[model samples]
Target: MLDRLDQLQLRQLRSALPRMLEPVMKPNHPTPEVMMASFLQAVDKTNKDIASFQEAHLRLQADGVFPRARASQKNSKGLKHWRASEHPDWANPDRKRSQIS
Candidate 1:
């Protein structure tokens, strides 16, 4: 059973765990603690997977897998909008109007 768990892909862990635990878990088996540890491990694995995916995406972007649009220097209209930040002060009525301009 443990060998089967080791073989499971990170994506398969969620569905496999509940089914495996249901029949074998008992009142005095300390299953809850074991389950919690398993749950944490799954969460950690998921986070690592997401981080790896994001890194791969960034690397692809850097490699120009997706091209970014080039901005024209003569286009002041488009440039002003791009510089607008959503900082707290940016929401102020005075700053909001000026920032967009």
Candidate 2:
């Protein structure tokens, strides 16, 4: 039947799709400094936008345009913790260590 043939073709397509898409995820090389700088710039821009939005929301509340404060999206990654003494190797780039380390 035509319906049976369609199901067979769909199964074959599903099996082939993973192989066809595998190369898309290959990692590209990028420097840590470049990534960090770009991330900082993005965070700065987001902070500015959030500040402006908060000011506008406050104005609207004062003018009785909205009854309550608006809820903003919460950051899931709460905070970062870094200790200098914890990873001495990171501080001393000259120190040689195993490749896995």
Query: How many backbone clashes does every candidate have?
Result: 0, 0
Q: Per-residue alpha-carbon lDDT of model 2 for 9-57, expressed as tens digits?
A: 4444445434333333335527656555655665565556555555655
- Please give the lDDT score for candidate 1: 0.54
Candidate 1: tens digits of C-alpha lDDT, residues 1-101:
12222334434444555544553454454666776776566666666655655565567567654453233444455555444464557557888788779
Task: Output the lDDT of residue 38, model 2.
Answer: 56
Name the TM-score of candidate 2: 0.36
Task: Give candidates' CA RMSD values in order.
Answer: 12.6, 22.4
For each candidate, give its TM-score against the true structure: 0.38, 0.36
Q: In candidate 2, which residue pairs get closer than 3 Å at backbone N, Cα or C atoms, i.e. clash?
A: none
